[model samples]
Target: MFTGLVEDRGTVQLLEKNGSAIDLTLEISELITNDAHIGDSVAINGCCLTVVEINSGTLKFQAGAETLEKTNLGLLSQGDQVNIERPLAADGRLGGHFVQGHVDGVGSIKSIDRDGEWITMWFEVPEALSLQMVPKGSVTVDGISLTIVECQPATFSIALIPHTLEVTTLGQKQIGSVVNIETDILGKYVQKLIPLKLDGFNERQ
Candidate 1:
């Protein structure tokens, strides 16, 4: 799990092809490198990737075909920047929300408008996952946990505060960029369980 709180922005150093997998190398700040070990998981742009090697301020991980197909990571190159976060500790505070580091769908920046001290970002969501989203509900966009302010047929909007804008990659994001999105894990689970329970209730009825 992660908090969607970005620790630092890192650049992809290299991408090496190995059979059906691609080895990703990232060079992060020393602050994010402290105590991190090989086999540890780091969320890069919202995708949980295992650390295959850790040397200097750089780390390597392997990305399979499935992960590439599900996220915006495939669009990344050697110099692309991504939000990075270490896995949450067992006794740490839940600063953001429960982020599995699993990208559920891909979204595109549709519009960005400033509202006084904050900004309103509208993005397009796929129809299949739109059903699980609601006003005031939580959604993880590129691993940044945010609340849904509005939901449309194919898009949703979030109100971003100054701190959020300055601390994460969203600050530099522009329209037409693709982002990885993970819907609320709790909401998805409840949506699945409710229907099963309803069937049992109806059978009793």
Candidate 2:
């Protein structure tokens, strides 16, 4: 599990295709790699990837066909910047909401509206994914935890502070740019349970 807090921005060094999968290598800072291990789980663009190899200041991970099909990582190119975060520790502060580092679906930038230093970015997402969101809810976009300012049937808007724009990959995003999205886990469970409860109530009536 992760807290959706980006620790550092990593640069994609290489992408070696092997059959349907790929070996992804990223050049990150030693702050994360200092205590990192071979099997440490790192959230890269909100996707939980296992560190398979570490050399110098780079960490390597393998993305399978399923992961590639579901995330924006498959669209990554060499030299692209990716948000990176280590898994939350047992005693770590929950600065952000619980982020499983599991990408639910891919969303594209719909529009970007700037208000002075703040930004209100709209993203077009799948209807299914949007149904699990609500205004003021938390959602992880490209591994950055942001609050939903407005929720539509197939889109949502988020207010980005200047700090967020400066630190993460969202700063460089453009219209139609795809991003990995993970809806709040709590919302998913509630969505599931509500249907079951309603069915039970209808049967009793």
Candidate 3:
């Protein structure tokens, strides 16, 4: 589990395709790599990737076909910036929300509206993914936990403060930029149970 608080912004150093999978290398700060080791889990752009190799300040991970199909990681280039977060320790505070680093779906920036230093960005996602969101609920975009400001049938909006924009990859995003999105785990569970309950009620009636 992760708290969704971005620890550092890592730069993509390499992306080499080997058959159906791609080997990714990122050069991050010592803040994350100093204590990180092979076999540790890291959240890269909201996707849970295992650390397969650690050399100097760079970490290597492999993305299989399933991960590529479900996330925006495949679109990454050698010089792109990605949000990086380590898993929350058992005694650590949950400053953000519980983030599994599991991308539920891919969303694209539909529009961006700025007011002073704050931003309200709308993302267009699949209807199935939007159904799991609610106003004021928690959502993870590119691994930064944010609250839903408004929820629509096929899109949702989030308010981003200056600190968030400055610290994470959201600052570099533009219209049509693709991002990884993970809806709240609680919302997913509730959504799963509701349909079964409704079906049972209808059968009894």
Candidate 4:
């Protein structure tokens, strides 16, 4: 599990393709000589990837076909910047919300506006994934946890402070760029629980 708070930005060093799957190698900015080990899961642009290779400030992971079909990682090119976050440790500070590092669906940047010290970004959510959102609720976009400032039927807006702009990738995101989206964790559970509760009530009736 992750908090959707990006620790740093990494560059795509190399990509070893094998049909639909590929070995993704990312070079971290910090010098991580030996801390990173094999089989460690790291959130890359909100997608949880296991570390297949870890060197000094560089790591490798296998991106399977499922990830390619569902995310924008498949569209990435060499030298592209990617958001990177290490897995949440047992004693780590949970600064952001409970982001599973699971990308629900991909969304496109619809609009971008700058206002004083803040910025507003709107994303057009895909039809299938729009059902699980709520106004002022939690959503993870490209692994950056954000509050749904305004939720429309098919689109949503989020407000970012100046610090968020400097700390994460959302600030540099372009208008037409695609982003990974994960809806609220609690909201999904509520949907499942409500149906079962209503069914039990009907049976009692």
Candidate 5:
């Protein structure tokens, strides 16, 4: 699992397609690359990927067909920047909410509004996913954990501090740019259990 806290940004060095899968190589930050080893799980743009090789200050990962179909990683090109984060360690602090690095669905930037030093960005999300969100709830966007400022029927907004804009890819995003989104895991669990609880209550009544 990941905390949705991006440690550093990496440059895409190469993307090679092999049948239905693809091998991704990134020139990652030295801080992460140096400590990384084979089989370590790293979240790339909120998609959990396994380290398959480390070569000449670069890290390689394999993305299967399912990942390519579900995420924006498939749209990556050479020199493109990607958010990178190592999995949360057993004793690590939960600075951010629990992010499984499982992209629920892809969303697109619909609007960008700025106020002083803060930026409020709205994303057009699938209606089904939007229904699971709440105001002030947690959501992972392009691997950066953020709080939902407002929730709507088919869209949501989040406020980004200046530091967040400077450190993550969201800073470079523009209207119509696609992003990987992971809704709150806790919310999903609650939504799933409510129906079962209602059934049990009805039986008791």
Candidate 6:
């Protein structure tokens, strides 16, 4: 699992189609490269990808057909900046909420409201995914964990501090830009357990 905390931004070097999979290569800073190894999992734009190779200062990752269909990763081009984060270590501090690096849905920026140093971004969630959002809840957008400022039936907004804008891809986000979103893991579990609990109650009755 990941913590949704971006360690550094990596630049896409190449994207190649290899039959049923896409090979992604990224050039990252030494900080990530020194610790990176083949087979290690890294979260790139909220999608968990396995490192397949590390050669000449570039790390290679593979994305399958399912990932390409479900995430914004397929839209990546050479020179595009992607948020990168290593998986949370067993004893690492939990800087953000639990992020599985599994993109739950793709959301688009509906509007961007700037208030001096603070920017409030409103994203339109899919009808199927909107039910998971709640005001003040945690949501991972392109692998950056943020708190929801407001939640509507089909949309949610989050306030981004200047630091967040400077460090991550949110700085370049514009209206209509697609982003990977992962709703709160706890909320998903609760939703899943509710029906099971209700069924148990009916059986006891």
Q: How many clashes in each structure?
A: 0, 0, 0, 0, 0, 0
Error of 4 at 27 (Å): 1.1
Model 6 C-alpha lDDT per residue in residues 48-99, reported as the tens digit of each score: 9999999877899999989988899989999999999999999999999999
For candidate 1, give the lDDT. Answer: 0.90
Clashing pairs in 1: none
Shift of residue 136 alpha carbon in model 4, Å? 2.0
TM-score of structure candidate 6: 0.96
lDDT of each: 0.90, 0.96, 0.95, 0.86, 0.94, 0.93
In angstroms, give how far residue 71 of model 4 lies from its true place.
1.2
Q: Which ten residues in a row are the worst by lDDT in model 2?
A: 31-40
lDDT order of candidates, top first: 2, 3, 5, 6, 1, 4
lDDT of 5 at 73: 93
Clashing pairs in 4: none
Ranking by TM-score: 2, 3, 5, 6, 1, 4
Per-model TM-score on C-alpha atoms = 0.94, 0.99, 0.97, 0.94, 0.97, 0.96
Root-mean-square deviation per candidate: 1.4, 0.6, 0.9, 1.5, 0.9, 1.1
**Model 4 shows how many backbone clashes?**
0
lDDT of 1 at 35: 68
Per-residue lDDT of model 2, residues 1-205, tens digit only: 9988899999999999989999999999999888799999999999999999999999999999999999999899999999999999999999999999989989999999999999999999999999999999999999999999999999999999999999999999999999999999999999999989999999999
Name the regions of candidate 4 deviating beyond 4 angstroms.
31-34
Clashing pairs in 6: none
3 or 5, greater by lDDT: 3
Model 2 bad stretches (over 4 Å) = none
> TM-score of model 2 relative to the true fold?
0.99
Q: Between candidates 1 and 2, which one is better according to lDDT?
A: 2
